[model samples]
Target: MSRLAVAGARHVVTVDPDDTVLHDTTVVVEDGTIVEVRPASAGPVDADEVLDGTGRLLLPGLVNVHTHLPMTLLRGLAEDVDLQGFLTRVWAAEAAVMDPPTVQLGATLGALESLLGGCTTQLDMYFHHDAAHRGALAAGSRHVTGPVFLDGPGPDGLTWQAREELLRAWPAQLAALGGPQVPVAALPHATYTCSPERLAQVAATLREVAGDRPALLSTHVSENAAENADVAARYGRTPTEVLADAGWLTGDLPVVVGHGVHLSDSDRGRLAAAGASVAHCPGSNQKLASGALHWEAVRESGVRLGIGTDGCSSSNDLDMWQAIRQAALLARLTSGRPDAASAHEVLRAATLGGAEALGLGDVVGSVEVGKRADLVLVDLEQPHLTPVHDVHALLVFAAGRADVTDVVVDGEVVVRGSRSTRVDTPALLARARDRAAAAGAAAEAS
Candidate 1:
């Protein structure tokens, strides 16, 4: 069996259930599962190869719970706008540019960025899912992706009937095109875009397909005031209430909502009772003037929560470090309490909380033995990270994507020394530039 050891980590932020932190530790991996986590001072480890983790902070790889991965090509295309206007312009651009090849190129670029930034897994909702799967694989990232359901034909020209077929067949399709870690999930865009009938159909399809294993249904809910108003006007209830009434919020299938910025108190109770999680996208919400997540109430209600970057088009970057910091600050500002969301809480939201949001808690959330080794090593020897006192605080407040020196997914070294081992950076850059230019010109012409 293949084995590897990350030896002598200055600190390992295990993000375990107890939030354990280990000093001078070695996390040993066999095949892909973590076999042992012991003190580096104990003894020599028997492994095929050993990676020096001295002066490094090993953390569970960040899980990005909500993203339109291929939207990387649309970054800065729709800026300084609210959700409605942003969607109008961005959808136009996507329609003009989001063919299979453009989608593939954008996904490749996004995946490379995500992996280099220490995000090992993602819950992505976008078009041309086959290309998205391939791109995330090339970066050695675990991913859950499926057809996006909208009321009308989307940029991919997939109709309502076609989307149903795609959603029903998602598991087999992903298996056929499998790589690193393939998990089946459904992503219906949102209540604003999809009707009640559509949501019911999606929920039914998901239930049918998820016979024994759990399936995840990810969607946007209560993202902004306008969404709430629109949803209420259309369905005579808030977005959260509409979802609850439609029977989408249930225990059988896991549901992860993106950007529940305006979820009501009662909505919180419903969500918590149904065992659904929310992916808090502070960066995108703040940028679009949507509103910050009410972390105080959400946490108090006992709902599962995680941080997300949303999509590059709205958030301008897929950097999870920035998302963590943004979430911390926004929680403080919105809650009107300095101690509302601690650095440690925000850090867990970025890692383990995100894993639970993606229904990957048992597989790739923490550095516990028997879990898959999806891990990141941050270079704490950097000038900024020098003299670290509070490790979790420093990680949430000071560290950024640049500090990620190495990333391993499923015990495989995909990033080393600040670069992706699985991607050709220069060639990928050139390809993206060419496609981006073409996409830009197409958008301009449109």
Candidate 2:
């Protein structure tokens, strides 16, 4: 086990409500867990490596609670298409051409991009998710994967059996990788894509496989107006209500809903009662012209909120900084109040809230003793982040991905000077370029 220490930080935002910020601090990590967080004046402890965080802001690594990482291969491919067109004409078509190798390469590129941009963890849902998990591990990033479950045939006619096989195979793979923290879960793509019976079966399987173990269950719910209307028309209830009927929205299951653009008040109540979280993909929603999620309502109803970039195909990037800013701006716009969403709230949404949504709060969210040592150091000496009045404000508004100086996950430094430690960036970019061209050709043919 490698022991590491980050010392002499100007400020450390712990994100713990009781102890929000630690000034002039040193955080010590041993064997992947945080060992001590003391004043810088306390002197150094034993460690193999040390990170000088002078003139930097140390905080918990940003968590992206929802994303389709493999869609990095499809970034900018459907730029002009609306949500429906993007889904049917571009996304579906491109997915057909994604074999295991292509999917793994795309996911590896996406993980590298995310790590370089200061995201240490992501909750990803997509097809070929075993490859995604492997890519995440190789990139030295923490990820919780929920393989997509559809009622009918998927791209390449993949059936539930394939998804089941992946799920069964991933646990041992993750264990072998020495990443026991990564959990594999079931993701019914959406209320529209999965039949009611199929959804219930997924819930049942998840319950069986994850018994007494904390697990995540995620899906897209009530994303578009048409989806809400369709669910209402079919089941005489909203999508949330239908999901509740199918045993999806229960207290025992740790559920996270993606998008959630058109949730009804009743749906919000149900989510609140069930302790379900919502992944607010503001960038993707704005880009796709999907209606904005009522952030105030969701928060007020006691739903845990986290920020996500969604998929690169819609959002165009995997930058969590951009997602945080967009989430704050959209919340303020939706509430028609400048003070509706605070900078600190948005920052929390990207970090601690995201960890809570993934049910990894106790282990990875905040910079506290006993938690995993996942941290990001932002260079505060930059022109854009100069004269920081409030650290949270600077992070939520002024800073960009370019301002990220270092990223550490599981006590290992995976990014230094805005570059990935585990991947060959030039090679990954070249492969992605080739795969993107092939994907584009396939979409056009379809």
Against the true structure, whose TM-score is highest?
A: 1
lDDT of candidate 1 at residue 221, scale 0 to 100 = 94
Q: What is the TM-score of each candidate against the true structure?
A: 0.98, 0.97
| Best model number under lDDT | 1
Cα lDDT listed for each candidate: 0.88, 0.84
Model 1 Cα displacement at 165 (Å)?
1.0
How far out, in Å, is residue 145 in model 2?
0.4
Query: For residues 1-446, what per-residue lDDT tens digits would candidate 2 score against the true structure?
Result: 77898988999989987638878899999988998899999988678988888999999999998898888988877777667777886656556678888888888988888988889999988777777778877898897885688877777478878766655665555566665275557887888888787788888877777656677789988877888887777778887887898998779877899989998888999999999999999988888888899789899999999989998888999999999998899889999999888988889989989998888888888999999988999888988888978888988999888878888998899998788888988988898898788888887776
Model 1 sits at a Cα RMSD from the real structure of 1.2
Q: lDDT tens digits, residues 1-446, model 1?
A: 99999999999999998888999999999998999999999988989978889899999999998888898988888878899988887888888878887888788889889999999888888888877878878778887788889999977778899988888787777778866564578888999999988888888888888676657888999999999999888889988887887788777677899999999999999999988999999989999999878898999998998988999989999999999998888888887999999988988888888888777788888999989999999999888998889999999999999999999999999998898888889999888887787666765665
